[model samples]
Target chain A: MTSETPAALAKAAERPRPALSMSTGRAGDRIFAGLSRGSGLVILAIMAAIAVFLVWKAIPALQDDKANFLTSQEWNPDGAPAKFGIAQLVFGTLMTSVLALVMAVPVAVGIALFITYYAPRRLAGVMAYLVDLLAAVPSIVYGLWGLNFLVTKMTGVSGFLNSYFGWIPLFGGSETGGRTILTAAIVLAIMILPIISAITREVFVQVPHAHVEAALALGATRWEMIRMSVLPFGRSGMVSAAMLGLGRALGETIAVAMVLSTTAGIDWHILKDGGNTFAANIANTFAMSGPTGRSALIASGLVLFVITLLVNVGARAVVARRKEFS
Target chain B: MAKRIEVSGLHAYYGGTHAIEDISMTIEPRSVTAFIGPSGCGKSTFLRTLNRMHEVIPGARVEGKVMLDDEDLYDSSVDPVAVRRVVGMVFQRPNPFPTMSIYDNVAAGLKLNGVRGKRRLDEIVEESLRGANLWNEVKDRLGKPGAGLSGGQQQRLCIARAIAVQPQVLLMDEPCSALDPISTLAIEDLIGKLKSQYTIVIVTHNMQQAARVSDRTAFFNIAGTGKPGKLIEIDDTSKIFTNPEQKGTEDYITGRFG
Candidate 1:
């Protein structure tokens, strides 16, 4: 009777099931799958909530009389009429990120390769463990260190660059010293180095030992093996590593706030003087704002949120491809 | 034809484990030397020592002299890199570089040793593929990824990559253990051809492969070995297989012990 009723039972079971719980699988398995899928929905809901809250809070400033929401740069969101434009703030965000990437990418890739290959085997392992430890170090500590030691040391570096390559506008090499985009970028490089290096090292180490051996058997030297086999094998990993590092550098608030002197302007000379960043502006002025000012600042946060989200998506895509090689 | 690889008082240790002990044998330079022993009897360890690959692992050390025409390989001042460049190796599994094209795989050794001219690299790649007898099947697909090749082709490509360096000695560690019989035959034929220009030392667990390819066979044994592995006998391959000098060797080759 059981065998004869198999098809009938299957047909009966094909009826639309309830989403809550009507399955043969354990509560744990079903719960895990549900949680994994539902986590995305949860994140989307939170993001939507934040956006709605921001728009509601920003309503007065968005409808203000002196200027539209995004056109003016005066940033007096609560002085009688209350006016501000994000051109300068947007410019600062783009400049700081661009400067950070230029400074960080090469050093990160180099450190990753060196940590993976050149450091003595025992030393390399220890160094890698330490870099991973560095990733866990609080952002505030890095800010404190950058403010105290990095700024002072960077002043001397600015003077030296002024003596050497002052003609290049990016390094106008001005004695205004190094608290500028250039110095902030250097500090950001140090912070991001550990991240990119750790990922690249992990990826390089995973390069099939067989390929490294094949290269060695082919008379390739250690360096040559890394260049031809390990580096190429980990190319996608390196790109994702760079993008992850850029994401961190873009969103870093405390360190950039502490290190950069808050001046407002768009100067192409990265070494000219300290400049404001979106994160720095938020951290610096949150205490002095009224309701309208608070809403304007929150809108700035929205910009940073969108920027970081894009960086994260790009990094995830690169990482997705990196996994394909395995 | 530079047909001798002399080993004297060879002892190897994996950080005091005493893996290979007091092993001494002279292998035919242009003929295959098969070291047949039980699983733990140091056959692979002994093979690696021939090319200084034994030292790749941390704390793995060898205390003995292996010579190719009187140059001491383990001498304190001798560079293992130079020794390896002269004595190439093929591991048990095929390990073609996944990132490179088939042409690049064959040309890797030449380019790394400062052979940079495009013309020369191109020529050597073709020569090596032909030498390993893989050129016919892969000649049309030299630009394709090397990892795309079939298992047999990949192993052959590895062989091509090894011999590309033009080493005087070839050390293979169970080269066919990871391949099908058809690929094994292809490698065997390539090995026969390689013997003209290279001295060959191979370690194998397959008794039939030993009988089929090698000219000299060295039988390793552990005698009540809470001790180290020691060489039991070394002789012409036919003699060792047909009538080994040691009873242990006889038992082992006749499908008795391992």
Candidate 2:
């Protein structure tokens, strides 16, 4: 009987089963797949349309402007010559966003680690919810709070830094007004904190138990474990989170405009109270200007759009470069 | 430099659930001891309690007296990190720090112990790979990521990493359960050679494997679901297989019952 069972089992194994061909996908399945693909293409089409419209509107402003658009610092689109440039606006946008990222990333990562590794289980949930609440606050509300409360409160601190560190180029100028680029960057930093921390917290939580145990088994202390296993594994994640925060800081309109009192030119020192980003400039001037002035604002908006795109693409390239081991 | 271990009145718990109860044994230096039990029988838990690795889980605690030569391992003053440095571990599935190269994986523990010179690290990394019997296949490619190795080679790399620090005791929790038969035989052979240098304690489910590699065998069993695991018998491998003192051990060995 055992011999017969072996022979029968061999015969059964040798028999071919039915082939699973593409014909198995019914018409309904194909239709659903097509719908998903169509949706993705539609999003691309919308993005292309917006790009085309921005470029169309920006060309007339470039033709009318007498000043060099790339190098000139003055923006007087309402004048007969319609002189304008993006140099100062570019500097303001990059400086404010970069400064905010420098201040926010370290604190965000610290808060994320504390919530993930150190806090008690019940308290961690509460802390995470509080961070989410920070993200939920309206930008207008933050603008009001920054303009009324934080700028006034920061006057003493700004004056103190200018006095002690004035020899440093970035902190060189005297602080005549409290509403400066420094205060605007502080407000932007506070705005982006929740997003970076929330994303970083999720990334830290996803570190594998096996890797953690591997570090612990190697006799690593708690801080050493974080440095060895947690940080390296979450490097790309933290970078992406920081990039997302940067994207927000770059395009924030009401908050930067409400806090920063713009002057005519760019200053090397951030404590001197005069800077204007593309988003804030458009919001502050678009409604009251003539057609050429409005087109100039759109031209600046186009520049901001391109800068953000380059930043995101650069971040992706960085992530791709480090993908070999991960 | 292996040291003997004496464990008495060891009780382990997860939250309020008692996992192992009243376990007592003396593990000899420079020998292989095997822990065999069914699933959920707490053999793995008992193995973890030896090196204090079990307490990493939240709410997991132990009440015990574990002496390494003269010092109590469970004393409040004895740092768990320090204990782990003295007692190394190899896990069931090979984990070789996915982001590190093969050389870095082996040298990681040594570096943590403050060995900084390049020449010394090179000497120790080569020595450890040779000890794990993985030198010939991987010496030319030490710069490669550790995760790129085959399963058997990766497991050996983990062994090399664990022994790089030259700890006194080596704890393995089902080290061969994830390998094929040929890889299993290779690891079994390596264990035989390693017994001369390190005190080895291993938890396994395969009775034949335990009989082959271990000098002494410990059998654990539970009365019913949710009951704490208890040690049924511990004796020489030959005696445990041929003439057990307990009926529970006899039944488990003979495939009569778990």
Candidate 3:
């Protein structure tokens, strides 16, 4: 009987069984799968349509341009020759965003660490809510606040930088008014701070408990534990967070328009006035420009879109590479 | 060098929930002492209290007097970080810092404690890995990420990391529970070797492991669910296995009940 049992089990194992269907499963499962797939395709379709639209509109403005579209510092798309370029706008966008990133990343990481490791439970919850609340505040309100309040307060700070650090080229030049690239960058830093910290806090919170205990058991102090465990684990996350903040800073429109005094050329002296970003330029000029000028604005918009896309892609690559080891 | 541990009237709690009742015992220097208990009986918690690691959990606190030879571990003047340096730990699951290389994982404690000089770090890393019985297997790939190692190797790497700082006491909370039988045997052998240099306190649910490795054995048990865990008896490994004084301890060792 025992010998026959093996053969019987073998026969049972070899017998054909009904296949478990996915698409042909219950009606609910099929409907859910279709809805999810349709949602994903809709997003892809919308992204493609936007890209096509930007390219179609930008081509006409490029054809009508008299000056080098990429290199020229002038913006005169409505002129008889319709000469215009994005050099100044590109420079401003990159400069302000990079500056904001440099200023905000350290503070954001500090705040994240504070929220995760240092604060009392009640205080941590309140602080986290407040940071998220900062992100939800309207950009126009920030623009108005920057123009009416923050700009007035930045004069002393700019003066301090210009005087003490005047030998440094970026901090040189005696432009008196507070409406400068530095001020705009500061505003952008404040605007992006919450988002960077929020994402960084989430990443730090997800650091494996075992890894943390390992560090602590190694006799690591609070700061050392953060340096050894938290920071290394969250390195890629912090990079992505900074990149996201950079994207926001680059595309910020009404705030930069309201805060910055736009000009036609790049200004190396960030402490001085006169820098304009692509979004700020477009927001300030789209209504005043003719049809060709509107196309020119869209062309600049296309450049901004491409730059943001590249930044996001680069961030994803960095995160994906680090995910293997982590 | 190993230091004797004297724990007296230790009681631990997490928030309002009492986890472990008053427990007292002396752990000898340069010997293996195993804590055996059922699940949720606080054998692990009692081990953590030896190194003041029990309080790492939020809302978890301990009231106890743990003395490492002449020094009281919970003294107001003693920093927990300093205590941990003197008393290291190895967890159940291997946790070699995922971002660090094997060499860095071993040298992490030394580097963080401000020990400079590449030659010194290299010497210590080699010594620690050799002490943990993992040097030959991992010597060629010291620069590789620690997480890439097999499970048993990773646990040994964690042991190497724990010993790199030359802690006086080593706490193992079910260190071999996650390994295969062969890996478990390897760790058991390593534990036998390690006890000669450091005071080893291990918590295990496996009775055979306790009998094989420990010089003395402690059994902890709870009255029932929601009741605090208590140390039922502690004695030489031979006596505890052959003839325990407490009925509960005998019943436990005989596998009559948990």
| Top candidate (DockQ) | 3
Better of 2 and 3 by lDDT: 3
> In model 2, what is the error at residue B193, expressed in angstroms?
1.5
Q: What Cα-based lDDT does every candidate model obtain?
A: 0.81, 0.92, 0.93
Instruction: Check candidate 1 and list the clashing pairs.
Output: A72-A85, A75-A84, B3-B29
Order of the predicted models by lDDT, top scorer first: 3, 2, 1
Find the 10 residues in a row with the least total lDDT in model 1 chain A.
A65-74
Candidate 2 chain A, run of 10 with poorest lDDT: A317-326
Instruction: Work out the TM-score per prediction.
Output: 0.89, 0.93, 0.95
Please identify model 1 stretches exceeding 4 Å from their true place.
A1-41, A51-74, A79-83, A105-122, A173-175, B1-3, B223-227
Per-model TM-score of chain B = 0.96, 0.99, 0.99
> What digit string (tens of lDDT, one per residue) describes model 1 on residues A176-274?
575877778877877887888888888887888777766666556678878888889888888888888888887889988988887765667666665
* Tens digits of per-residue lDDT for model 1, B165-197: 788888898999999999999999888888888
List ranges where model 3 is wrong by over 4 Å: A1-25
For residue B75, model 3's alpha carbon misses the true position, in angstroms, by: 1.1
CAPRI docking class of candidate 2: medium
